[model samples]
Each structure stands twice: as C-alpha cells, then as structure tokens.
Target: MADGTRIVDLEAVPEDGSYRLTAEDPFGNETELILVRCDGEPGVRAWSNTCPHESQSLDVGDGAAIRDGAIVCPRHGSHFDACSGECDDGPAAGTTLPGVDLAVADGAVHLADDRYAFLHEGGIDDDEPGSTSHLSL
Candidate 1:
C-alpha cells in the first residue's frame, strides 16, 4: 500500500484514545482501520477495525470505546487490548484483533494501510455508507 500511508496527524489523535481511518484493502474492499494512541507506548498502534464475533466494524462511527486501556468492540462489547490485540471478555474472549504494522514519521501515524485490511465478501454491503471494513484474528 505505497510503503507507508499516512493515517492521521499524531496531534489530532488524543493521547490515550483512538481514531478510525478508512482505506482500500489489498483485496480492494474499502476498509476501516483504527489508530490508537496509548500513553503506555512510545508511538501509535493500529488494527483492523472488525470484531471477529459478528464480523462487525469494532468501531461504529463514534469510534471504539477505550475501557481501562483496551478497545471495547461496539458490536458485542468485547474488550481487546489496544497494545496486544488480546481479548479478555465478551463473545470473542479468546480472539484478538488483527494487528497492522505502523510507524511514526513527520508527526503522523503511517501504516502499511492494506496490510491487514481484509474480509470475506459475504454479508458486506459495499453500497452502504461506511459499511466497508476488516477481519481480525
């Protein structure tokens, strides 16, 4: 995906919070990728915004909720650690979000944009606004 696509300006993303960005996946599916800023880490973190349980975008526009430093999936309330993508609660208890490789450069979060942005065609309605998305581990 062009080496490293700039996702967002670092200052625009709140420390200890998250932001959702859109991209075209390697498979050509319009996808949503999430950018996370954690105080415990030196740089930004990222993941495919899809929750495994129902293949729903973990973020439903308002952004995924950060609870105790973890990402709480909006679909079924599953909480996944933003740092490690580990899930410890909800229907996706043993699964983790698929991680995306990221880097910090020139005051922005740059990602391998389409690296992890993939999902099966089934149930995905490309015609719906922002209905495009991801698939996490």
Candidate 2:
C-alpha cells in the first residue's frame, strides 16, 4: 500500500510452504527472504531464509516444512516461528531469524523495508545449478 515493489500475490504463498524472494540491501548485498502466512493481524510475515543454527536455508524449493506454526530447518530441524521468527525449542533456541519488512494490501505482498529493494522471485543461486550446500555431495 505504500508504493513498495510488489513481490507476489497473497494467495500464491502455499499454506504449508513459503514463497521465496531475493532482495538487495542499500549497500547492494543480496539476501533471500521467506514469506509465510502468519496467524494474526498482518496475516503475513517474512524472515531471512537462513536458519540460525547452521545457516542452512529454511526452505529448499519444495518449501520449508511447516508444522504447528513453525518453519522447520531442513538441515538441523530447528523450528522458527513463522509469525515471530523466533526459535524456542531447538538448538537455535534463544535466537531469532532476521526479519525482512513486508506489507500486505489489496491481496498483494510488497517489500516495505526502505533498506531493501526487491531483486527477483527466488533465492540467490536460483539462476545457477550448482550446489548451495556446504557439503561436497
């Protein structure tokens, strides 16, 4: 609603998964964000896609496993609250995922943080077919 870059339709985000998008900071660093339907007023929230425990991505294309309102880390299984991005029951407990500002209005999701500009509709490595994993597999 504030003339920010529109990222996606609100309904496009799967109820069980997240919508991935990339954004560039004012300094020109790109970061991936994961969007999920939240449980309250704004109805949507976003966090940097990295898990605090091992820096593993929360969503790996198919979607981050959402269970009981938390986004499960694909590598270590830590659960970050989809709404608050806080972890309270895993090795990543006491840590919070970095949040990316978002706004929902008129059935669309917009990049509301002035610090970031929307780059594209996927992760940083989406254009390349190489492994983003640290392990050489």
- Give one digit per residue, the lDDT tens place, for model 2 in 63-102: 7799999999987788888899989987899999998888
RMSD of each: 6.9, 3.6
Error of 2 at 4 (Å): 1.3
Best by lDDT: 2
What TM-scores do the predictions have? Answer: 0.74, 0.89
**lDDT string, candidate 1, 1-137, tens digits:** 23576656788776555676666666676666777766555466777778878888866655678888888877788988888889988999999888778777777766754354423221234444444354446
Residue 70 error, candidate 2, Å: 0.3
Model 1 spans with C-alpha error above 4 angstroms: 1-3, 113-137
lDDT assessment of candidate 1: 0.69
Question: Backbone collision count in every prediction?
Answer: 0, 0
Residue pairs clashing, model 2 = none
Clashes of 1: 0
lDDT of each: 0.69, 0.84
